[model samples]
Target: MYAFKKSLSMGFDQAVEHVVEELKKEGFGVLTDIDVAATMKAKLNVEGRPYRILGACNPPLAHRGLGLDPDLGILMPCNVVVREEEDGSIAVVFMNVATVTGLSSAEGMKELGEDAAAKLQKVHDAL
Candidate 1:
């Protein structure tokens, strides 16, 4: 699958905090955070579920990837999503790093991807 997902037994706000902390522990820093629900409400006057998209990056890993392939910027920061389900549960989802960076033909990029994926898996396992 393209994503690694897990349900968090906590409120939306709490889940977001926990996910961020876990990511940080895994050497990732949140570069961007988009509040999808609020954005949709403001821009289109439409209501949506509580959803957030976090663009996370490990500078060291990202640097390595760039050195291998400058074009790696296309997948620079990995995306982690936190959303509240209709059942009142929250779910955390992160993209599969190995699968994403696998698109690159650059050597050693896959190893970097594997390292990243391992860290992210740790983050998920922590939850």
Candidate 2:
């Protein structure tokens, strides 16, 4: 699977903040925050539900991945998505590091992927 998902029983803005806090507890930081809905509205003049794509990174883990393969930088930061459901509920989705890292054959990459995935799972469970 490309991602893990969870429903959040909170307001959209609150859920976004909560996800960021949970990620920090796991040593991850939000490096980039893309407001998809707002961007679409500004660029394409389209209407849509609230959605955001957060680029999350753990500096230590990213450093390790880079040391293994410089090209791995392309996949360094994982993406987490926060969006509102049609029913007005909030949902958050986390990137599956294992699935993405499996594309590389670098030594110890599998273990690294598993480690990151476990940490993300903890954040998922925290919600």
Candidate 3:
């Protein structure tokens, strides 16, 4: 509904690496990589499975979106999450740009969102 999800039969680190590579191929870059598991353990003294939140961005598309609506910056970079499941499988999830962008009232936001979603779909299909 709000995201595209896939389960990977690979190591946690490997899955993250693969997802990053695929994003790059789709003209997306990893702007930030947050290791949620480690952060939680250090900041809250809680243990958890391996989990990472990747902030991905496509510079050209971001520029266009900004030109259309400055406030769209709130959703600038997309998110791709890679987390280890209790079943020992890795899960890779991608933000559904179309769903999020639909919230905007900008004139061309829908088309822009569809374009971005297609690119992400390519990455999803690749993996």
- TM per prediction: 0.98, 0.98, 0.98
Cα lDDT tens digits for candidate 2, 1-127 = 9898999888999999999999999999999999999999999999999999999998888888887778998886899999999999998999999998898899988888998999999999998
* lDDT, candidates in the order shown: 0.94, 0.93, 0.94
Could you tell me how far off, in angstroms, the CA of residue 55 lies in candidate 1 after the best superposition?
0.4
Candidate 3: list runs displaced more than 4 Å: none
Give per-residue CA lDDT, model 1, range 1-127, as digits (tens): 7789999889899999999999999899999999999999999999999999999999999999999999999886899999999998998999999999999999998999999999999999999
Candidate 2 TM-score over all chains jointly: 0.98
The deviation in Å at residue 105 for candidate 2 is 0.6
Candidate 3, run of 10 with poorest lDDT: 68-77
> Model 1 residue 88 lDDT?
85
Per residue, candidate 3 scores C-alpha lDDT tens digits across 59-112 of 998988888889998986899999999999999999999998998999999999
**Native-to-model Cα distance after best TM-score fit, residue 96 in candidate 1, in Å:** 0.3
Candidate 3: give the clashing pairs. Answer: none
